[model samples]
Target chain A: MSLDQSFVGRTYPPTAPYQVGREKIREFASAIGATDPAHHDPEAARALGHPDVVAPPTFPVVLTMAASRQLIEDPALGIDYSRVVHGDQRFAYTRPVVAGDELICVNTVEDITSRGGHEFLTTRTDVTTTAGEPVVAVWSKLVVRGEA
Target chain B: MELPTQTFQVTRADLVRYAGASGDFNPIHYSDRFATKVGLPGVIAHGMFTMALVGRAVTTWAGAPDAVVDYGVRFTRPVVVPDDDTGTEIVVSAVVREVTETGLTRLDITATCQGDKVLSQARATVRTAG
Candidate 1:
């Protein structure tokens, strides 16, 4: 089934504030097998001029991916999750994530296109601090395989 | 304006292990025949896996094992991994580019496979102690 074209350009509400914690960052790093000190030790981060532990550059994926659920689960969108495969992802950052930041993400369905038995959905997630500081914007594309 | 980088190869086994660990069992990453059938030159690494590696390079360089405040990436190109004894090598790198008055540090980052930019125009930020 094709995605609802009307949903294109629709923006969802900002997510609840997510506190960037030292432990969460550490867990994500460990989950990804990242063995970086800056992602685990505050002292090590501070020594490198950080106020506390810093998250890896891709940390915003957690926030954005969560925010994007609004689109995937939108009843009006008519997306078939079972047929979807991640086509691509990219992040444009204004800054690196750090512990002690309260961040929020706003999700938008940027575009939806269909071609040759495939549906392409593009979503964008904007990450910001509670104070409205821009952190990064994540754009992801998902391709839905043809119905067998 | 930035610290030196730590470079290393990310092998095919590493990609396979990452796929198992991440629960992203996409055949294009493991099955070479499936990968070739899909028109990719050969088996390719997951873009997220490479993105995770870039995150590793930045956090490790900052000296904090956990200090990432914000990070994002775009998959401009795919990393093709040919079945060979040495496998494909992905080199992740980053350098401090700017410092803001709010004590935020921005780093320009990249993840390359065989010198071709797989992830491009990447950036990340961290807060510094005043």
Candidate 2:
């Protein structure tokens, strides 16, 4: 199904708060093979001026990607999950995500276009703390391949 | 200025770990049968996993753990990982495109697997250590 251009600029409600945990950060760091001391030891992170273990730069995807499901599953959007492929991703951080922070996401449909028998949809997710502090902005583009 | 190149080994074990960590359990990244049925060469690495590795290169270059201010990439190609102990490798290299007086360093990044570019139009802006 073709994406409806009218959905561009549509914004979804803020997602439920996700509490960042030290073990989660450690697991993610380990998965990516990031050996930074700050990602594992709280003492090491505190020495580096962080209150707790610091998450790797790309760790926000754990939150944003799930939050984006609201948009992709929107009946009006009519996104066919089977035909979708990740096209691009971007992250702009105001500060590194730290363990013990509660983060929320607001998803917005930034743009939509069709090309070469495919439809491309870009969504921007603004991540912030529950207290209204901006943390990171994430953008993701999905390409839906047309059926032959 | 050109930064030193960094290489990362991506094994199937790594994919399993990343899938658990990132909550992306797409069978194409693990099940060869599913990947083949879906028209992929084989089990492929997650695009975000590659980007995370590249982020490591950026932060390592900045000499700080949390120095990245902005980063982006387009998935131009996939990094296919054959099921094996040795797995595959991704080489990440970057050149300083510009350094602003305000302490921002802009870099043009390239990430390749088997000498073919996997990420295109990749770039990062990082805050240099004082």
Candidate 3:
């Protein structure tokens, strides 16, 4: 079944605040083999003017992915998780993500299109600190393949 | 001018670690059975994993971990990782597209696995720190 085009431009409610942990940033950096000192050592990050360990550019995917569940699991949207493949991803930052910052995300359906028998759903997630400081805007396009 | 190339090795173990860290436990990334059932060649690295590697390369080139202000990529192909000791490799190369008066350096990046492009339209903007 094709996705409802009406979902486009729909913005979901803001997610609960998620505390960005220093160790989680370290773990994420280590997993990707990003050995930058600013990613793991608070002192190094401080040396560079960040308050604490700074997350790498793609780190917000951790939060936004969890936040996006609101759209993927929306019974009305009817996204077939098993048939979905990531099509595109992008992030534009207002500032680098740092540890100890409590973050929240609001996901919005940006676009929906069908091509070659597949539905492409583009979602944009606006990430901000609990205090309403904008952190980054993340966009992800997922392709829901049509059953053969 | 072209920037120095960065290389990263991807293994099944790396995928497992990434899945745990990113909270994206999609079976297609770690389970060969589920991957094949889903019509994939075999267990594949998460697209975000590859994107993170490319982000590392970008940050390395920028000389600061927090330099990146904007980054984007299209997943053009799967980076298949067979169960092995010496897994696959992703080679990242980039060119400086522009440097603005405000100290932002824009880059056009390319990421390849086994000489095949895995990401397309990859680009990043970094704050040029003194």
The C-alpha lDDT values of all candidates are 0.76, 0.94, 0.95
DockQ scores for all predicted structures: 0.29, 0.90, 0.95
TM-score of 1: 0.64
Q: What TM value does model 2 have?
A: 0.98
lDDT string, candidate 3, A22-126, tens digits? 999999999999898999999999999999999989999999999999998898998998889999999999999999999999999999999989999999999
Q: If both were scored by TM-score, which would come out higher, candidate 1 or candidate 3?
A: 3
Residue runs of model 2 more than 4 Å from their true location after superposition:
none
lDDT-wise, the better of 1 and 2 is: 2
How much TM-score does chain B earn in each model? 0.89, 0.99, 0.99
- lDDT value, candidate 1, whole model: 0.76
What is candidate 2's CA lDDT for residue B102? 100
- Candidate 2 lDDT tens digits, B25-128: 99999999998898889999999999999999999999988889999999999899988889999999999999999999999999999999999999999998
Which 10-residue window in model 3 chain B sums to the lowest lDDT?
B29-38
Displacement of residue A52 (Cα, Å) in model 2 is 1.3
Ranking by lDDT: 3, 2, 1
TM-score of each: 0.64, 0.98, 0.99
Please report the TM-score between candidate 3 and the true structure. Answer: 0.99
Winner of 1 and 3 under lDDT = 3
